[model samples]
Target: MTTTPEILRYAAFTDLPTGGNPAGVVLDASGLDDAAMQRIAAEVDFAETAFVTGRDGDAYALRYFSPIAEVPFCGHATVATAVALAERSATGALRFATPVGPIEIVTTRGADGITAAFTSVDTDLAEFDAPTLERTLDLLGLDAGALSSVLPPRLAFAGNWHPVLVVDDARAFDGFAFDPAEARAFMDEQGWPATITVLHPIASADAGGPRRFEARNVFPVGRIAEDPATGSAAAAVGGYLRAIGAVVPPALVVIEQGRHVGRPGELVVEIPPSGGITVSGRAVPIPDDVG
Candidate 1:
């Protein structure tokens, strides 16, 4: 408790230090209390900071805190923490005891870097409420006509709840703009951390292609305006696609996020026939001077 904890910085979902979402990892948070953790997270000032409270055998108790408050779960932070742990320990399967549930993480080291895959908890998919949808459209300055015909709006949950919204126009999706304050209010009302907004440019609504999709995640609830890469949201989207029969079993989809903010990163999602969804991406240690 007397010693200063090392806040190692790592970028999740991308090998480049400048790309992907930056997360602060406190490998050992043994003596830190809730207030201390919150203060450290605020000082780090990333989208999310992960603290490893203790380790019981190979399982570690983990918690996520943002600048403002604590969140139930975080996708990118889990991957980053797993990679950080793998770098120090043996690179293999690891379990994390989160507030939501125990998350299984499998990490591997290669020439590219450390790659971590997280298996999500049980997923739930339902039509997103109409009132929330309307409020979101108004806040984003868009109408129902802007929505994609093939991909309907649905509320999806894996570790955290995220409303999946699909847009038709690529140009409009690329130029996404939303009021942060309005989004924060909406998120507070719904108790959601973020909304998954995506655009699939394929002319046909066909399945089985070069698995990739463009996405922008707005996370006002977590006190982050926008996230560069969101693994939980990506996992929810994968489950949503599967639930709607848009994708076949054993599918692999690459999610591209954080383009507008210039921190572009890719997250690979794998959907099994009938089980939990898996999200995979690489993480590289960020330098002390990196923004």
Candidate 2:
């Protein structure tokens, strides 16, 4: 008898199928080894793929793989996979024991769709050492003069590390363009620090409960040129803002990404007074043929 894991496709962060970042989910990867998982991820060819290896009483062992290699964690894939599990079980919370640590996921069914919220591991924010920032700006063809002084560049980590760079407006974020080959070389030289999160704050016209932000992730990484929405990056941004004291406590930050790439999506990041950041989004199944 031959056994094969069922690969599920889901787009996270958007109710509509046309938007959001697509992720590959393997619900039961108990028997798949490292090589097999890598092969599956490459075959799926999304920015990232998630595999579930074991299910304990309350926690599932989770692993994430990019097309190039394995990563410690991924947020959008967690949201997508959590919604898939929530559909089959009662409404409540599910926990995943990732390589980084255990992350709690809560799911709900609503008129819009099945939404999953995942609390990231405690974030560690750091300043990029010296010339790393300068090198990054050069690679992107950006000047330090164009960046916003209020929100300076910093390195943030939840499950993975992403450099948070803030510009004055959408115009600065939209103007960023880079060569994939040169970018790849830079990443390799700089030790492959996930994706660089470039962001611009969208001011609220009215008094605030929710703050809006626009972001783009260096146009491309891995095999994909653009990710419609990035949950891990959003989490990192939340951590960065909190560390920099740029955002008020107990705030809801709404992030927009992938607009220029055409697959627009939104991510809701909730920053509590303290502890891990919570990132929430809906995941819709993508048909095999259509994907």
Candidate 3:
């Protein structure tokens, strides 16, 4: 690389810098190549880092890289990038050309902070075969009985595919464990670099509000054992719920994650009748000391 890129640290999905998923953002990655971006991401040592490689008017081209590999899409990092851009520019609509497809994000500055919402690409779902389901359950230290009867085992895709495992009992959900190496190998085999998303239904904080869920994303391929907040996985969760008819159309789904890692955050998912799901959350700049 000719020069060092300016990397901004931001925590997505929460107002507090220390209370969300931290991601590295390179707003101007003009001269950086893939190798340089990957090296920078590794140096940053976050779960994911976003690079703005190209720009046209209000639209930008973005690439996401984890420490170990390139990812097609990363929700938290996208939010971080969007917020970073909004802070420098204006709060409004922005388009990102990603590996998967084009993503539309809207930034709004509120009293609390700068909140950015991105509508996911077209979503799809696939059920797990018997053998695959059995193997996954085994690796996760869970049995078929522990799974929620409401949401079956399936692969949900928003930008990337993720295994959606919803446990009926919250206790079982919290109690399940797995070997990261084994899980990572299995995920690699399945062509899923994304997290194995585990969700447990929880009571909504507001009466008669959106459906609430507590989430734990297992991804041991990188620096983190568990993601504090997984925006892409949360988007896939919205698709899974909508596809499975778990929630009514035009519903709102609330996902609370990161408490396990002590970085509690919330993601607001808006499900329309038939289209991309919108995941919204605020991002805050991470202090240099926290980096």
Candidate 4:
């Protein structure tokens, strides 16, 4: 029996080829098992990869895998897969049934070319205890004063849980760094799945635009040092913003990530008037035969 090549490349969240997070896209994953999916992701070595199977009406059942394991959902990979499909079949809307819940995507073609935006599952936010916050800071090698009291420490989840730690200033964010081993150890002790450390400066005050934020994600449990672009994290931040009442209803925000490691990606999040958050971005193909 001949095995089918099951992976494709997509650069998520940017129009420029080099500006977004790269994800492995598997358009059809009928026979692939958990082990095979994990192996393919590891071979691609991108932050995340998406596998689509089981069509249900307008929505398709989707699963996400990292190099080491499977995750509930991944935003950048979703964006990448949607755009990849749209580029070939013409731009339109696509729906996904993820481990978390249903996600929606709309693809379009404009003068700048093709693009896509993904809507995440329903979100929730909850505050963390003082001890948890203190321990997390210690793990990251950050001082207590470095955090923003205004933002507070909260566990936000769109599909998966992420603890959002807001920084006092962008300069403090610049100095932010952590030993992955130490950080992983601390997270294990806390019993949290995975944690993403984010630092954000309010976007320029000029246009009253949606707040702009920068983020860094650590997925030690997934055996990755950092993620270039994260959609789940973006939804978590949206939930955090809404929980604090910092953002008004019908909010749209832009998240800039992946710059530190050179693969920069963007995520645009839309907070609905009723509920749930939508994350949108672009995904471009990576040549299949490239070695």
Candidate 5:
């Protein structure tokens, strides 16, 4: 008899099934080595893939791998994996022991299925020097004016390090373009693990309520030109918002991404009064098999 690994695909951040970031999940990757896991992730060809091994009570030990390498943490993939587990077990709270640290996830079952949300580790922000920022902009083919003064240039981290460059509006985001090779080269020079550039409009009052913000993420280090939905980046943004005092305590913000890729994703970020950030979304299974 032969054994096979179960590979499941789930789109995080969207309940509509069509919209969200797609992640590969291996619920039981007990015997796989690092190289094997990397190969599996590469074969799946999603931005990130998650592999799980042990579970202690409600907590499980998990690892994340990109198509090219292993990442310390991945927020969207975490949410996807949790929801996948909830569908099998029962919808409720689960814990994940990741490379970064232990994370808590809560799941709920609706008419559609189980939806999961994960709270990120404590976040921090740092300032980058001028030369590095200039070099980065040069590689991105963007001028200093293209950057938004409101957000400024900062290195933000929740689990992984991402240099966040915020732009003024959707037009700027839509108009911006860059060579992947050049961007990668700049990141290599700057010693940045990953670089994410986001463009957002100022908050506006609407008839319904406060309008949800629209944004796009450009990820060059993962060998991806752009990510459909980026929960890690969203967590970093939430931390940034808190650091800058943009939003008061106990605020909920919506981040819209992947619209340009035709796979629109929505991420809801909640900031607690005490601390930490919670990112919530849905995951849909992808039909595939792995071992």
Candidate 6:
């Protein structure tokens, strides 16, 4: 008997139902096979959909799928799934066995709403060679001069890989254009990162406050111009900053994203001295009527 799994919708990185990235969450997907999950994701047509296939005690086996294919991990979907689970059960610590590895998540409820913070798998980073950087810039319709000297381009990984490009001028960063098909091909040729994150430094920590940035995460293959809130990309950014000696360990960075898409959202990143980065956000259930 083929039973239909219930699909829950949530917007991650923002408590507001209208803001943030929307994701589909299947709390009980044990009966669904990989093909069925992919079909469900395609039908949902969100940036990503998460399926909870198995559970033992507090730990759950998770799989992430985009509208097109399966992904190793997804941060926004993780937050949405965690918040969904917390609402059903209790708010506290939970473990997820993801394709990458085990991810630890802590859920807490405050006066406002439920919030979830997920610690990513071990993070790694590498600088882009000159030719590769040039090709990347060209594909994005960006020039070398637009690149920020403080935070150069690099490939960062925390569960999934992302190319972090810090732009010196916010205007140029916002205005650059590229063909989706071309960009997707280039990305596929260059290792298929989950997203290409372009950031503009809003405020520096040396200026007497927490380091802040505004970001636009591009994932052309997903058929979306920009992702509203990218938790995995934010985690990768933390790794990039730490590995490049841009931030002192044990720092908190605020990333403001999705403004360009008109669905503004925020992601908080915590960087420790070593290991994986932690990305925190709140997710709210998106009413079925909204979609």
lDDT of 5 at 3: 55
Q: Give the alpha carbon lDDT tens digit for every residue of 1-291 in model 2.
A: 537789999888987666788999999999999999998999999888999999766799999998878888889999999998887777678999999899999999898778899999988898888699999998888888878988888988888888888888566678878888788778767664467788887865255547788888852556676567888889988888888887778878899888977778889999987789999989999986665
Each prediction's number of clashing residue pairs: 0, 0, 0, 2, 3, 0
- Report the lDDT tens digits of candidate 6 across residue range 1-291: 899899999999997888999999999999999999999999898899999999856689999999888999999999999999999999999999999989999999999999999999988988788898898899888989999887878999998889889998877988988888888788879886589899999999988978999998888745576889999999999999999999999999999999888788999999999999999999999997885
**Candidate 1 lDDT, tens digit per residue, 207-251?**
546467888888763446888999889889889889998888888
Query: For every candidate structure, what is the RMSD over all alpha carbons to the true structure, in angstroms?
Result: 2.0, 1.7, 1.5, 2.2, 2.8, 1.2
Q: What would you estimate as the lDDT of candidate 4?
A: 0.78
Looking at model 6, report the run of 10 residues with the lowest lDDT sum: 218-227
What is the TM-score of each predicted model, taking all chains together? Answer: 0.94, 0.95, 0.97, 0.92, 0.91, 0.97
- Of 1 and 3, the candidate ranking higher by lDDT: 3
lDDT of 5 by residue, 1-291 (tens): 435588888888887556788899999998788888998899888889999977766679999988877888998899999988888889988999999889999999988777788898999989888988887677666778878877777888888778888777556667778787776666666655544656575464343544366777766645577788988888887887788776776778888888887789888888776456898888887544421
Superior candidate under TM-score, 2 versus 3:
3
Candidate 5 has which clashing residue pairs, if any? 5-290, 5-291, 9-286
Off by over 4 Å in 5: 56-58, 205-211, 221-223, 287-291
Error of 3 at 30 (Å): 1.1
Q: How far off is residue 91 in model 2, in Å?
A: 2.2
lDDT of 4 at 91: 84
Per-residue alpha-carbon lDDT of model 4 for 1-291, expressed as tens digits? 637556788788877667677888899887787888888888878778899866877787889887767878888888888887887788888888888888888898887767777766778887788888887777676788888887787888887889898887777776777888787777667655545757676684246777788888876634567777888888888887888876786888888888887788888888876567888777677665532
* Candidate 2 weakest lDDT stretch, 10 residues: 218-227
Residue 238 local lDDT, model 4: 85
